[model samples]
Target: MAGIGPLTQDWEPVVIRKKAPTAAAKKDEKAVNAARRMGADIDTIKKFNAATNKAASSSTSLNTKKLDDETENLTHERVPTELKKNIMQARMNKKLTQGQLAQMINEKPQIIQEYESGKAIPNQQIIVKLERALGVKLRGKK
Candidate 1:
């Protein structure tokens, strides 16, 4: 009562106490104690843990066998040299540059370049688009 006035009052700061151990932590501690009572070597467990951590650290290493398999799976039949020549000739006859032809077909110029250079994998949809744009047979029997 003496610490309070019309415009003043006393306040105590809050104290934070340490939390009690969680159930999982208590269970792990009990297991460790039981293992010690059973004469299980703590040193061997420590060594095994260290070995596991070391193996995990080195697990980022690349497996070249899997990489080779992936690359092999990615292999595709490239556009034929004759097809490349025909595309170039047709584009030249139409007076359309690679960029222009790509624009006409709504494709990136790199696609046209890839087709002309014989490095493109044959896709039926793109081939059909190119045929319609260039008015030429680019695939199968011509």
Candidate 2:
């Protein structure tokens, strides 16, 4: 008893209260209420809110489309063999090297090589330019 210290007691429970709204928040709420009372139509606000919600939801969604192998292969179509043959024969008849033909057509030499090898992706503009430069009917009916 002589060596014992003062006993500690539990404190009384204190009531907790939610924080009051800030001045700005109260002003904004008053303004919205006043606008509603003054017959301000909420349709525009509703539309804007709906649009934002829709855009947000769509942005978070992932594109999960399945691609077909055959369609994927067909998408990157190359120049036809007949077209390649015509380009090569025309170039030879014109006595112009690949570089010379490319320069004459205002294109790169690699482009000319790709066209002749049938590995190039067909471009109507490039074909037209080649036809004009070489005076050969490379593409079209027969």
RMSD of each: 7.0, 14.3
Cα deviation in Å at residue 121, candidate 2?
A: 0.9
lDDT for model 1 comes to 0.85
Clashing pairs in 1: none
TM-score (all chains, Cα) for each model: 0.54, 0.50
Stretches off by above 4 angstroms in model 2 are 1-74
Instruction: Give the Å shift of residue 132 in candidate 1.
Output: 1.1
Question: On a 0 to 1 TM-score scale, where does candidate 1 land against the true structure?
Answer: 0.54
Top-scoring candidate (lDDT): 2
Q: Which sections of candidate 1 miss by over 4 Å?
A: 1-47, 50-52, 55-77
For 19-55, candidate 2 gives per-residue lDDT tens digits of 8867997887788888999999754243455545676
Clashing pairs in 2: none
